[model samples]
Target: MPKKLIQRFSPKPETLKAHPHLKYFGEILQNPNLWHLNRRSAAGAVAIGLFCAWMPIPFQMLLASLLAMFFCVNLPLSVALVWISNPITMPPLFYGAYRLGASILNEPIREFHFELSFHWLAHAIETIAPALLLGSFILGVISAASGYFMLRILWRINIANKWQRRNKK
Candidate 1:
């Protein structure tokens, strides 16, 4: 990861500390690990963020933030990455997860029309919740592991390249 790039874009600790809503978090937000842009923190944040992004629930950012805090990872990066499943990509991602889950469970795929109502949501959940949850969990784990390892590998490679150039100098 480009530490400077991430640091530049991430919210400043002072800004977060000054926010009224964030005041509830108090000293917890003051943890140095949560703001550090090092390899381990960055990789762990990626894993935490990606995993939460696949979750079939509201407030993925909150989940990512909590996980980041618990794991002592980069907090802002983890929360920001949960936007991967925003309004535009959510439908397709959930649909794919549902399909994968149904296949894994050997259940027949059902064709249902979408409706913007509480009744429809309730009915849909009753029929599809199992497969959707299962598939989402599977995908989340895969995404988290892939993100963690990929970041770790890329960070190591970047360091090695920098070392080589310095040696040549």
Candidate 2:
């Protein structure tokens, strides 16, 4: 005897409309051009956003968002990318920046310490003064370019699979 076929069903439109955030999510999900965006453009935006986000610059999130919007990238994703150098990751990220600066300038790695004394602010500035500007920019650019290429390759593979599935259907 032959087996019966099973039919799968999608959620109804009314069910989707009930959730508030779903409306926005649905808009992105239904955009036909989402997959059509050029891989290079997507990659470039991701790279630039990630780079700007990871830099030790102040107001990095604002900068990344502005750049993302300026570049016509997915703003949410770019903003989310800012966590690349959050509190948890700051140690290694800043260390890498210091190392990069030291290697370039042939200088020894400077020791960093934080104290609550009245003069702590002045001391901190004196320690990090020289390397802050250049180190942050170099590392930001490197990380951003790396993130862009990595994300591009992954996205391409994912989009290709999706395209193949759509074609098959």
Candidate 3:
């Protein structure tokens, strides 16, 4: 099986425990289920991470961790996937999400520059926030479901291929 995709980023439980931010989850973060690299856990981790990455808020990684803890997925994988919306990709990703939202809502897609200032935020909230929020939520659901199933299918194929090779041997 192509297990190394996960193992490349999957940190040891002790390594996570040593991280300062994870200290907030207390003993809950230490659960064995949260660290398991099995198919179910890994798929759920991708789903949870994808969903949380679409959130229009700060501390996305923290939120992903919290959701993974709640849903019993691989914690490190959940944290890593939120990098999908990292600063470098944020503008285009969010703009696409906003466009999707506007199209779904049948609202006019607003044209605005991507700016991080408070004035821009306030203006955006008044103008495109509704479409943006709706679009992001919908996109998140779609992304999470896609990631979950994609991982599951790939994992299944990998295992099947491995078994076939072993039988040939």
Candidate 4:
């Protein structure tokens, strides 16, 4: 059931090949494993996506895509998963990460209001950088590992069920 859901939603392999904007990827995108929706590919993509989603940077999808190609994961799924950190979800997730970082480093958490000025933003970032970075790393690792194992288990259960059904017939 999970496999079927993936296949139904995953883009056709040709989608990337035909994309004019993705030309920068050049031949790297040609790797067949990047397009396949198999257990390994899907699991790797999910992991990559989860990892990239926690990154507090621009172009998260691009990063996910590059890593997916390098790791031979499902390219579309890797890119799609980064959307889990979309605008609606960004604030709480990032706050959670910051809190986690503060807890881990045993640092006092500061409460500050948002200031749009460059000086204020830079100062805030400098003060919070350590916590934010550490929290993001920890969260990313945990989520990525969880996603990989969960997908693998789901795949195994799906395959076993298929085999049982086939044998019964």
lDDT of 1 at 74: 93
In order of appearance, the predictions have TM-scores of: 0.96, 0.65, 0.91, 0.95
Q: What is the full ranking by TM-score, best candidate first?
A: 1, 4, 3, 2
Q: How much does each candidate deviate from the true structure in C-alpha RMSD?
A: 1.0, 9.2, 1.7, 1.2
Q: Model 1, 24-136: lDDT tens per residue? A: 99999999999888999999999999999999999898899989989999999999999999999999998999999999999999898999999999999998988999999
lDDT of 1: 0.94
Angstrom error of the Cα, residue 117, model 4: value is 2.3
- Per candidate, the number of residue pairs that clash is 0, 0, 0, 0
Candidate 1 Cα deviation (angstroms), residue 40: 0.7
Off by over 4 Å in 3: 114-119
Residue lDDT tens for model 4, 48-107: 999999999999998999899888889999999999999999999999999999999998
Candidate 4 stretches greater than 4 Å from native: none
| Cα lDDT listed for each candidate | 0.94, 0.63, 0.88, 0.91
Candidate 2: C-alpha lDDT: 0.63
Candidate scoring better on TM-score of 2 and 3? 3
Q: Write the per-residue lDDT of candidate 3 for residues 1-169, one digit (tens) a residue.
A: 3568668756779988888986887899779999888899989999999998888889999899889988988888899899889888888888888999899989997778868899998998988999889989999999999999999999899899989999999
Q: What is the overall TM-score of model 2 with all chains considered together?
A: 0.65
